[model samples]
Structures are given as structure tokens and as C-alpha cells.
Target: MKTQNQITVTQIETIEQFESLREEWNALLFQCVEKDVFLTWEWQFAWWKNIGQWEYQLWILLFHEDEQLIGIAPLMMSQKRKFRFHFRWLENIGNPECDVSTIISIEPQKTISALLRYLQEKRQEWDGLELMEVNATTTGNQEILKTLEDSHYGFWRTKEEHFYIPLMGNTWEEYYNQLSKNMKHNLKRRMKRIAEMGTVSFKKYSGNSLTWQDFQTMCKVSEKSNFPDLYKSDNLLSFHKDLLEFMRELGWVQIEMLFIDERPIAFQYGFLFDNKYEDWRGGIDKEFETLAPGKLLMVFSLEERFKLGLRESDFLRGVYSYKTDWNPLSREFTNIQVYNTSNIKSKLAYWWVKHLKPIVESLLSKEKQKEQQNDSS
Candidate 1:
């Protein structure tokens, strides 16, 4: 490896460059002390191939020293509207199932300064820079934000609360006992009621081990449980299939199926990454709502995570009351927009959107209400 001061930044220009650097990129990414699966090449490439579809341009920046790869920032530029200037954004290309998306690398101490310098030098080429949906708890984010602030990049707030649960300890029983008495009682009561009806069982399988029938059943059940209309979208189904296959290849896929008397009732699809298990998707048979199969599946999955010696259980992006009952702390995230002063019009538009947009919307809403009242009278 080369010394820190000898590092060079190169923009990945083609798919060939990306492919050539895949192994080294992933190695450095995984070496980070608190890296998440979202930063994995499998996840990133899958997003580019499956979802990006030439609509966006990728501008990955690599930091290398003496022929040793150390850092990367996966960035994309996309046009929102004709009148609105294009924005350059950086993220992990995370799905709803993943948490904490941003520009991350193995050695922040060495690479962060180089990254900021590069962005600062290229400020005139891009309208703005956005790092969206970053997990506030991670030091990677704190360091990056501080560097950007010191570099005089524009900053704005987006969101303040994200929820996740911890899965620490040796056994499920011990972990469950940590919950409030009321939560424990409720979970037990639900399990007992479901058990009284028929023999209930749970199975965890991976994409490689799972048959095609298993995937079909999960899709069907999820469609029936969540949104039937959404299930019919061909792109969505294809995306799910690709995600499952990719996760399975990385040995991170986990499919938990719940059954009653040998009939499938509920199922969950999640991933195990960086010593943490994320509950990404799930579906339950609405007909079995009385049995609370969804709750049973979650309880079983939590236990299984503990059995595997994982450190955390993330419910992903959503905020639901049921998740809080498990005693996990909620974290806040930010959506940042940074721009250069050289692009005056673009900068003005961004400022209007960030600061004055809410006030404009509120006033418009009030005007609409008064007009409606006058017409009615």
C-alpha cells in the first residue's frame, strides 16, 4: 500500500473499469469497521443493472495509493425535470430493506480529505451534491458531514427519526425477557392462541437452498398481505428475484416461512450482513390474521438472529409501534443537498426548494381553502 499523501483519485469512466476494480473495491469496503451490506458490490451492481437502466450516470471515485485501493464514493447524476437542473447525488443505492445509505470507504482518516478536495475542485461541473438517507449514528457520516461543512458545502435537514432494534445476547428467551412485561405477555398470548389452533412451525432458508416454488409462494403471500396491485408489477417481481439471488450468493439471504399444519401462512425475507440482521420484507395470509402469523414469524426470526450470534436487528426504514415494543433505539437520518456558488440560478432554485418551498405550499393550501369556502357559500 502507498502512503496516505501519495493517494490518487480516479473517476471510474466505464463498466469495464467498474468490473476491474470490483474485487479490490469490495475488499476495502468490507474492511471498514462498521460497514453495512448496502456498500457491497453485489448490492451496488445489482442496483445499476436492475434499476438504473441508463437513466442515470454513474461517477464512481476511487482512491488508490501505490496500486492499493482504499476508498470509493459511488455517485450518480440524474435529471429531475427540464426546468430544474440536474443534481449529483452520492449514496449506497440502498433499498427499503436496507438502512444508512451514503458515501463510505475503509479508511476515512486517509481518504476523506482527498474526497472533499476532489468534490471541491469539481464544484463547477455539478449543480449540487446530495448524500441522502444517511444513518446518523455512524462515525462515517459524522466525519463526512464535518468535512463537507468545513469545505463550505450547503447543508439542509431532511428527516429526524429512523427506527432499528438490537439483537444481542445468547438466547431468544433472554432477549425476550428484556422487553416490558406487557409486551412479553402480549407476545406469549399471541403465540399461545396461534398454537392452540394447529401445529405451528418455522423454517429459515436461503436463495440457493430455497426452491423456485418457495419464491413463488413468498411473492404470492406478500402480495395478498400488503398490496395486491403492487404485486402485479413485473419490474417489481423481477427486482425481488434478482435481490434474493444476489443476497443468496453473498450468504446473507434469510427467508423465514411460517406454517400451520404444513400450510404456509406467513413469510419474511431479510439479510444477515456485518453481524446484523435486517428484517426487510414480510407477508402474512390475511385469512390467518386472527392467528397473528405475522407476529409469530417476527418472533421466530428474532430468536433465530440471536441463535446466529448477530449483534443488531434492523426493521429497516419504516416506523411502526410494534417494532418499538422490542426495545430498540430509534435513530435519525439526514438528506443533504450541497451546491457551489458559481451556479447562481441552480443555487437559487435549490435555496427556494429548501427554505421557501414549505411556506409557499402552506400559503397555497390556505388560498385553496378560502376559495373553496367562498364557492360553497
Candidate 2:
């Protein structure tokens, strides 16, 4: 680590460098105020190896205090041409994929200052930054955003919310009884419908116990569910396969299947890490849609987690009545896009993201709506 001032900044730009920092990376993770399962080394490494490397360049940064690691910003940069405009921008490793993200730092101000100053100096390499899934509750990120606001080089967009249920050793029955009346009624009615069809059962595989066949079975059902986009691509499918293998060895993999009459009906897949269960992805068979097998699986999964005394149940990203019905708390995520003052390209890119693109998209959406109404009429 090279030191110019009190806080020294070093960057990890190679896969080999990332591979070597596994232990140190996780050790710093525990010190973060906004600790998240998605922010772990395993998740970032898996994403970078399988999907990100092909699309983005690694730009992960490390902030040090006289030889001791203080903070890390897991970032990547990508370039693209859209509508004849050539642009390059930086973003967090898990954009549109992983749910929650934040800098791994014990000293919020010191760490953030070093990182931003470093980025400010190297601004010529990238046009702008678009950080996603940053937890609003974390002070480290708040400091970073404050610095940006004061510097006049960045803008913070509208916040996005992610939901999680605080388990805290609560009994499953106690928690279930507290759900909204309508949710309880609906869940029970659907469950009864499922029970009438045949005997119901659930099977879970985790860590070394999870097999490729089990994951593929879940994938088959998920493809027919509401989230077909999650698996419709070969690259995305391969990404999950790779993630499954990497996570399984560390006892982080958690995939649970619900069955009726010995036929699989739903799959609830996620990770069990840091004593919290991250509910990442799930799907139910289209044939069992009428029975709402997904809700049943959610119920089973939550109950099982409570039984294990997990601290929290993260529903990940998205807002749905089904998740809301469980009475989970919402965590808002704020994103920022900052540009280099000296670079004209960076200013234009920032302007496009912060102003022009939204107006154009809104106009296009309204036009599409009008066309759809005409077709329907």
C-alpha cells in the first residue's frame, strides 16, 4: 500500500489479487455497520468470475491506515455505445443482480475520503459512477454521499427499498399469528387446496449437501414462474450454476423444495450466512399456480429458519404484497452517480443519467401506453 497522506489507497485490479484477499476481505466485512450477506467476498467473487469479468473491468479499491486495512470498495467499470453515444461508467459489482451493498469500513469518514479522493484523481479512466443497492442506514455510505454533495461532483437518486423480517429468536407460530388477517386467510386457503391434492412435503439442501441435480430441478420450475428472465439466458444460468458450486463448500447454499404427492411444486433458494437467511430467488411450477405453492413454500422456509434461530430473513430486492404481508421492515437503498470535474465525457455521462435519460424514457413509456390502449380498443 502506497501512502501519500495519512490514509493510503490501493486498488485490486486483477482476479488473482482478489483471490488472495479472501480472508482479509471477510474479516473487514464483520466490522461494517451495514453488514449484508450479498456484500461478502464469496458473492462478489462468484459474480465477477462468472458474469462481471466478461462485461466489466475490476476496479476494487482498498483503503489502509498505516499498513492496516480499513475499508474496501468492490467496484467495476464498463463501456457501451447507445444510440451513437459512446460512454464508460463505474458501478458496484452487483448491479441489478445482488440486492444490498455497501463499503466495508470501520472508519466511515476516513475510509470514504480516501476512496473518493482516489477516484477523483483517476477520473480520466472512467466517465462516471453508478453505485447501486447501497444501504441508507450505513454511516460509511452516508459520509461518502455527504462528501459528494459538498464537492458538487455527484448526485443521489431516489431511494429503493428492500424488505427483511427480524427473526430474533421469535417462534414461528407466534410470528405467523401476527401476519395480516387477509394474508393468513389466503395462505391457509391455498395450503388447504394443496393438501387436498395429495400429501405435502419439503426437502432442503445446503452447503456440501447440495447437488447440481437439485439446483437444476429448481431452475426448471423457476423458468416457468413469474421470474423467467432470471434463467432465460444461458449466461445467467451458468452464473447460478457456478455460484451454487462455490457457495456450497462454505455451507452458504440453501435451496428448499416443496412437493405435493411426491412431485416438486416450488423451490425457495437463498443463502444462510452471518446467522441471517437471504431470500434471493424462488419460483413455483406454473401447473401449481392455482394453489399458490410459492406462498406455501415461503411459509415453510420462514418456519424452518425460525426453528434454526436465525437472526433475520432478508427478502432481498422488490416490493410485493406477498412479502409485505409477512410484516417485514423495509430498508431503503440510495444510489449515486459522480463525475470528474476535469473530464468533459464524465460530465456528459452524468447529465445523461441524472437528467436527459429519464425524460426520454418517460416520454417513450407514455407513447407505448397510448399505442397499447389503441390496440386494446
* CA error at residue 292 for candidate 1, angstroms: 3.1
- Where does the lowest 10-residue lDDT sum fall in candidate 2? 80-89
Residues 240-266 of candidate 1: C-alpha lDDT, one tens digit per residue: 677677677667877789988787889
What is each predicted model's overall lDDT from 0 to 1? 0.72, 0.82
Candidate number with greatest lDDT:
2
Reference-based TM-score of each model: 0.85, 0.89
Give me the displacement of residue 145 in model 2, in angstroms: 2.2
- Which portions of model 1 miss their true places by more than 4 Å? 1-4, 82-98, 229-232, 358-377
* Cα-based lDDT at residue 242, candidate 1: 70
* lDDT digits (tens) for residues 1-377 of candidate 2: 45456788888889999889889998998877777768888888878887898888998999889878888888898886744666677788977797876677888778777776777677667667777777777667788677766775756466788899999857899999998888899998998888989999999999888998898888778877877667767777777787787788888879999998778889988889888899888888898898888889988888989999999999877899778877999987776776665666666666777789899999999999999999999
Regions of candidate 2 where Cα sits further than 4 Å from its true position? 1-4, 232-234, 352-377
